[model samples]
Target chain A: MATIKDVAKLAGVSASTASRALHDSNMISEATKERVRKAMAELDYSPNYAAQNLVNRKTNTVGIVLPVRENQDSLGNNPFFMQIIQGISSICSENDYMVSLATGRSNEELQKNVQTLIRSGNIDKLIFLYSKKGDPIFDYVKQQKVSCVVVGQAYDALTDHIQYVDNNNFQAGYDAAVFLGQKGYHNIVYAYTDLEELVQAERYEGYQSYIKQQGLRDHHLGLSRVDNRANLEKLQSFLAKNPEIEAFIACDDIQAIRLQRLFKEADIANNRYALLGFNNSLITEIANPSLTSVDIFPQELGEEAANLLLKKILQESQTLIIPHQIIERESTASIK
Target chain B: MATIKDVAKLAGVSASTASRALHDSNMISEATKERVRKAMAELDYSPNYAAQNLVNRKTNTVGIVLPVRENQDSLGNNPFFMQIIQGISSICSENDYMVSLATGRSNEELQKNVQTLIRSGNIDKLIFLYSKKGDPIFDYVKQQKVSCVVVGQAYDALTDHIQYVDNNNFQAGYDAAVFLGQKGYHNIVYAYTDLEELVQAERYEGYQSYIKQQGLRDHHLGLSRVDNRANLEKLQSFLAKNPEIEAFIACDDIQAIRLQRLFKEADIANNRYALLGFNNSLITEIANPSLTSVDIFPQELGEEAANLLLKKILQESQTLIIPHQIIERESTASIK
Candidate 1:
């Protein structure tokens, strides 16, 4: 609530000198700078965002779009998105940038709301969450030329080349297959969500290559998602018909959790089958046998994505790729 | 991006009429309102919060002070908070309000924040998530005479005074006990979060009253939380100490999921040691032994709380104590 003038008066310095010291510009003496800072802190002075933004022509604020559903990712259940956002927020906060969340479930509605913010010239940059194929939002964002970075893989061709942060998903999939094969868990079933997603395609290829290398090729691949209970039930029916399936590789942790729950209902527990999942979500920790899944470092992802967006607004750089790691839990075990 | 004048010219109405229509004031004719709305839609006119707020002397926005880590309640895991927020947001968007989130973990900091917001006159009213025992946030709110509605329970001192929404905590605990008892499960274990909280205290009291009334004297209460993994380990130790415990009632779904994981590790599936959890969160659907828990109708809570806050802000009288219900899931019984 305190103004710059309040600090200046308290520090016995002119308002201009106080502001210069606060901005850390104009080469103020160390003693003067410290005095100004002490006065500012005592008076609870905060620099004005609105006024400062006009001179820089950038707000250092990143606008983020998420699904309106609170359970879109389940807050604690999947810390991937939340953690990424946290990372982005931390980076921005450190650089004095603010993050605002804008949400709508439908793509059309989401686009309109984002356009409102875009046209308002409120945010200098944007970080998008969706990676759905043929994303209309991405297309619109490209047209607007708002410095942008995507958390997911790029969906389509656009005016501006979008920088993104993603794991080496194909390599991860390939490695999962190799690990399962090394454990002597043959007759593996690679069940996943939409196979069209680039991440899924890479993982499936990895699974296939591993099977081909093992000379135990005639295995099954079940495709379904935990997000859709009906599709999961359908996938369960398919799995029931295929008795050759022993080990499983799920595209994501949520899918693995649902599959495990279904398997349990069919009287299958750990030791009967090995299960490996991705995203290393909270599901991995809570699921019976504690699922072993890949940790994509969501919080780091968010932080990186946010920083990338900030750099774009600052006219710095546009590209970055964070690393990924695997966490071992009870779900997958050496074939015993 | 279009102004009121642009909308007015397109709608063939005066600028004053357009403003009145946008504000939803009683002055505008129905035909005029329809025409202005059509123009606004065509022009992509997103309403201005600050300008309208200046004229109306109201922010229309209500602040929801949340704990820094909000994954505690079912609202954290379930899309419940999102659903509630969406419901409130729908009304706010239609009515033109900007919702701001503030952190409210420590009482001193919370008091400082509430005071700052009030002194700055940023928001129209406050909607508190949990009205714990004489929380400092409430104390400051009362001191400021700021309009507020407590989403959870209010103590006896503020019961007839402050507007609040109360969940049937006592009923939920009583029903849970009765349900377990009827299913031929006695010598139950009442596992709860720290009952220093009013809501928790009420729930515990309800459970105790039920046991006393039914003459079922073989139950013990224990403090078990999932905020940390060590507490979960402590819960495992508690279960080991009292091997005779047939069923455990968890206060929160996260706690139940943690309990479920511990049970799995200890090889105690639903058949032998049944567990009934509270706050029918998303954990129930995905947790290994889906939880049977209470539903506090979070969306309704948000709506009712927002409506009450608005009423108070407008100097309109409103009352509280909305109802709650129980939702049964697999954690309870697959009994004949």
Candidate 2:
């Protein structure tokens, strides 16, 4: 229950000096800060952050909003978000800032959660883990005029008004095809679900363009998100009719694994075809053949997004692109 | 900025009534609450939570502390924490609470991070994701008199003093061994790392007890956490020397997958032995022969922990045991 004044008196420093030392201000010498800290610790003086926030008009907390997904399992199963969160949390902790996670099972719930967070004035900045066209959460945050950063692509209309960090998904897709081609996979197919997400669309576009430029036949296979039986039949039929296809590039690692499982169920020999995936998640390394994946460096994406939002010069909209790499593994090793 | 008073005046209510409505107090009638909400929305009034928190002496935030590990990749690679966080976040969002993550790469760093979280007076409660004997973080939280719930087993000395939610790990191990025996496997070996964690020890104990009670020969393998080369060789030699062993029970899914990978490198046929793992993580399904694992239900553990901490009765120390299930898959199918 000791106050800053008491700590200052005990440390033989002025109250203002104690306060500055508590904030780790450059104006306060390390020796004085150490003395004040020792005195505070000795007196069991816990600083009231709520009161400090009121006075400074700062919360020293960042809000991380996860996207609302229809399949809630994605949130739990995907390690990409976890890695990004680790990156963000590490940086935030280093800077002495707390992280507040906002999540919900539905869009309305997510919006309400975010509204409550922003309205409560508990977070000074917001970071959206995913972005999409005409997202209500994005619109709401923008209307509230809260400083925020998006970790994925911003819509064309709002790109000028938002700061974002992303990988070049189109280029990532193109690079995947090029890598597979170099690995001697001539007839490569692109397989994805019906989610119609921005990243998938962009990547598919890149793949399509690469195929057309190479004068090769471009094959696309769409799988249902919910109906695994139909997907199995679809994959089986696709393989049956296209015996010449050498590889299939999935939109992400999860899809890649799903396809790999389907291939096994359909009695397809592992060496007959190659598989490539994105996001370079842990699953890629655990998959039977140890999948070849595009390492999107999700952690770096998170760190850069946090840095952009926390940067003092927040007036201008900034875009940061984290590079992606092709990690060759056993799944693609058969082709070589 | 619009104030509560302004919204109250616009809604034809007293400031106290408006405050109660904002907080959704049962004292305020539904009609009045709706009117106040409408007026506040019209006036674009955002409540100052810091001031409110100062008056209420509550931050409405829970701090989640992740265990410090020697390998940082474990934090990112493992999906257990992610699922647990999802469960915790779902319940927290429902009750209008924010989650703050405290992470560190080392014990000292974690202690400092946790100390800052507690001393900053920013969180009303703490949840430790893992429990260890003589953990400084746990000791610090205990000393600070902070309400906390541990998601893993508490040490013998602190069991009566602390609340915890954990699966009956000892029973889980016994059940795993029983499960393998029921699948017609006579010789089973328990494989684990050298970390000396409580859960592993308990599981191994159960396995050991089951083997003794059933009059079966017991086998045990200790793998290094860091040295994969040594582990690969050890596993190879163990398999070579013990051709009678029909199954290997891994402490968790990660180790199970590691063993599977090593078996492949050692040129062991997939059908030669059954692999059983705990945690039933995504990796179990993705592994080539799909590992059979014990579903410890990490998310449920998280939910139970949060419920215990947030329960109104804070005086009594309580322990909640989440049930575990054995999910049968391909890895064990060959033995059957």
Candidate 3:
């Protein structure tokens, strides 16, 4: 209930001095600032953020933009986003900054919402949860000259102009195939959804390169977002035609699980084919055979992104690659 | 970059009138507001939210409080919180209000952070993501008289004074028992963790009531948040002693999956016991044997809570009970 005037009187300083001290403005001497702080502590004064924001021209808030996924269900079902958010939220909380989410069902809506968020001056910085080439939101943020960070691979054109944190998804895919091959499973295939996404493209490229280097016949399976009847039939036909395929490397854990279900329906025994997935999420542990997955360290990616965005001067566009680790589980236990 | 003055000039009104019209203040005529809207559209003007907030004394932001769990990993592992947040985010975005997350590692830290959020005048409303009996955060928010809504059951003392949205957890528990009972499973046991939470306590009470009514010997299993060796040993012993228990109703899908893993290790056959869990989350679909779960409609709960908090007048302290349904899956398909 104590006002700035009261704090100023108790600290033996003018109201303006107390206000400046509250913000730790260099204009006020350290002695006066310390006196004002003690007075504030004695009176338990909590400065109004809105008022301070106006004075400092800073909101002390971060905006997190979630990609508008084609499959809306993925927005809720995917634990990857939540894990990254957890990492981001932890760092933001520690820094005394609040996090605000910006999401939409479509790109147009997402762009408009983000525009409004930035124009409103409610956020000091922004963190894009995903990255894609030629994203309008990315361009808009760049034009606005706002301090921002991306949590995935930036487009090649903007690589030197943007700050991003990502796992070496290419290496992850190559490693998955190599790990399975090391176990003597030479007939391995890559499974993915939405090859248009840079993540899928990069990972597939890595897998394809490995296959070519080893002189193995390369086979890949594409899946729809939803597990509809068409998808099941496709999986069944693929399995029937490629009976020699002994293992699969999926782009994500969810896809791995869905494929596992489809494989079961096709009457394929669990041990008949080994499976490896990415994003060692919770489902990996609960999965029927307990999935062998690549841990991309999503939380660390988020944390690094936040750290980059909060930097005082983002003079040099920095790219931090969080390492990925392959976790061996029951699904990949088959030894030759 | 057009200002209010430009809009006012184009609308043939004073700057003050244009500002009021922008807010759609009751004092402004509909004709004048329409004129100002046209001018704003023509100029592509965006109002600075901080300045507007100062004038309106409203932040147009919602604070979401996540419970401080003893097991920190649960904060990220459990999809329940993320689902709720997605629901809250969608609704808040629709209303053009930003959602801010308030989280901490301990009860004391959570309380302090929430207090700071409120006192900072940065949020127009607050939503507590979890409910616990006699929680200090609940008491503090109530004392502050902030427009707030709880996403779980209010304690008995505050039931009449708080607005809350929750599933009938007790009924969900009772229904789980009845669903299994109707399947001709006479011997049923309940599995849960941390009964101190009202959710666990209420569900257990319902399960216990059904067991006593049916003249069946009630058996229960308690597991820790993490799958530690101690927990595995405890589960092993419980299963060893309750070999005759035909069905198990778990408090959540995650716990059910954990139990399934433990049961597998103990050499219990999938067909040997019918397993049912709550919170029909993503894990249910991925779990081996797939879990039959009670869909508590978590997103709806979150949406309803946001709706209640954003209401113009929360005079009645409304309590909404979202209905729960049993989602049958492979885990509970056996008719024995």
Return the TM-score for each candidate structure.
0.81, 0.88, 0.89
What is the clash count for each candidate, in the order shown? 8, 0, 0
Model 1, range B1-336, lDDT digits (tens) per residue? 588899999999899989899878798888889999999999978765444444555554466654344332223333445545554544443434445444433455455545544543445577776666656667767766567777666564434467766677888788888888877777677776677766666777778888889887645555444344665567678767877677877776766776777666666655566678775655577666667778776667777777766644443443455566667766677444
User: Using TM-score as the measure, which candidate wins?
Assistant: 3
- Give Cα distance to truth, residue B314, candidate 2, Å: 7.5
User: Which one wins by DockQ: 2 or 3?
Assistant: 3
Q: What tens digits encode model 3's per-residue C-alpha lDDT throughout A1-336?
A: 889999999999999999999988999999999999999999988787887788877877889999985543566677678778877877887777888888777898688778878877878699999887778888888788578888887676344467778888888888888998898899988888888878887888889889989999899999886454677899888978998988999988888988877776667776778999988877687666788999888778877888877754454546788999999988998575
Deviation in angstroms for A300 in model 1? 1.7
DockQ order, best first, reads 3, 2, 1
True contacts kept of each: 0.09, 0.57, 0.56
Candidate 3 clash total? 0
Candidates, ranked, lDDT: 2, 3, 1
Q: Tens digits of per-residue lDDT for model 3 on B11-69?
A: 99999999999988999999999999999989988887777788777777889999886
- Pairs clashing within candidate 1: A83-A298, A83-A299, A84-A298, A84-A299, A84-A302, A87-A303, A88-A302, A88-A303
- Chain A TM per prediction: 0.82, 0.88, 0.88
Interface RMSD of each: 5.3, 2.5, 2.5
| CAPRI level of candidate 2 | acceptable
Q: Please write out the lDDT profile of model 2 over residues B1-336, one tens digit for every residue.
A: 898899999999999999999999999999999999999989978777667787877777889999885654677777788888887887787877778888887888788778777766667699999987778778878878688888887675344477888899999999999998888887999998852777888899989989999999889999875566798799888878987889999998878877876786677776678889998876676666778999988778878778877764454446688999999988986465
